[model samples]
Target: MLAGIRQALPEAVCLVVDDNSPDGTAEMAREFARENGCEQNVWVKVREDERGLGGAIRAAMQVAIDNGFDLFCNLDADLSHDPVDLPRLVETCLSENADVVVGSRYVSGGAIVGWPWRRRVMSGMINGFTRTLLRLPVRDASGSYRCYRVERLAGLDPPRNPSDGYAFIQEVLMRLHREGARCVEVPITFTERRHGTSKLDLPEAVRSGLTVFRLLATR
Candidate 1:
């Protein structure tokens, strides 16, 4: 993924935020940066404490804001999201004047690969339920592969967002929608992770479901 991003966007800085993985992911990132001679542009932020996926992303956004970046894209490190599609997301945001651009699997031309039927069904059901319940115009509400305009995202004060897991994706979209942010969805193929275990589980699913209700109640 790091190689792909560097190849695709040579000018863009890459930030790898790790939750102090036992596998030495942070050290690996530093080694890669040095080996590639991208130490000037690439950075590794190691979180000594536990912070969920959402928190990690939120921290990255804060970094982007602090460093004066105009836009930022987030993708999974497990290779599920294709780095080649980064340009499309950014281009769509620019061409369509969108505040957020989601790399969607539920849209036309989008697809999921290497997943069993059961997993596919569950993902589809969750996306469908969340979209209907939240009244969101997007087809894939839970997808985290997305590009955000920093000015618009900064307006939301992302650090203070309540969600700490996958639910953060839904909460940000809902909040952006309410704030009249323009959003666009670009089709992309989502592949299953080739390494490590998926973080999703029954408990996380239930928590995400309850998060939807909490969001609705607050509204």
Candidate 2:
């Protein structure tokens, strides 16, 4: 994913916020960046797991904000998000005058390939429920493949105890909307990763659903 992104947007700053993966994923990313001579444009951030996905993303956002980049993209390093879509989404946010642009799976042209029926069903149910509960117009509130305007995100104090897993995406979107960010969704086909097992389990899905309600209620 990093290689593809580097090939696509060589000038764009890419920050990799890595948790302590036992697989040495961070080392691989750094080596790739160095080998490609894009180390100046890429930075590897290591954080202990005091918080999870949401916290890591927030930390990255803070880095971007501190560095004076007005917009930044957040995505999983697992290649579920197509790096080729980055430029279009970044362009759309600037052209369409949106504060957030989501690479959506539930929008008009969006599709998910290689997921089982149960995964699809559960995703649909949870996103549908979240849409109703949060009143967010975005078709894919839980999508992590997104670009955010740093100014909008910087001004808001979003939830401190944000969900660590999939619900991390959900909370950020809802909070961005709640804080008056103009969000737009763009359809993107989500392809399953070829390498690893799914990070989400049955317990995590249920936990995400409950976490959504908890966030909605608290907000």
Could you say which candidate leads in TM-score? 1
lDDT for each residue of candidate 2 in 1-219, tens digit (9 for 90 to 100): 887897777789889888877789789878988798888888988887554676788789889988989889987777888899998899999999999999999989999998999989888888888888988879887778998998888887856676777787888788888888899989988988878877667887888889988987887
Residue 116 in model 2: lDDT: 90
- The 0-to-1 C-alpha lDDT of every candidate, in the order given, reads 0.88, 0.84
Error of 1 at 159 (Å): 7.1
Model 2 lDDT on a 0 to 1 scale: 0.84
lDDT (Cα, 0-100) at 157 in candidate 1: 52
Misplaced by over 4 Å in model 2 are: 49-51
Badly placed stretches (over 4 Å) of model 1 are 158-161
The TM-scores, one per candidate, come to: 0.96, 0.94
- Residue-wise lDDT of candidate 1 within 1-219, one digit each (tens)? 899999878899999999898999999989999998989889998888777887788788889988889999999999999999999999999999999999999899999999988888777877888888888879999899999998888888543438878788888898888889998999999999999876666678888889889888776
Candidate 2 weakest lDDT stretch, 10 residues: 46-55
Say what the RMSD of model 2 is.
Answer: 1.4
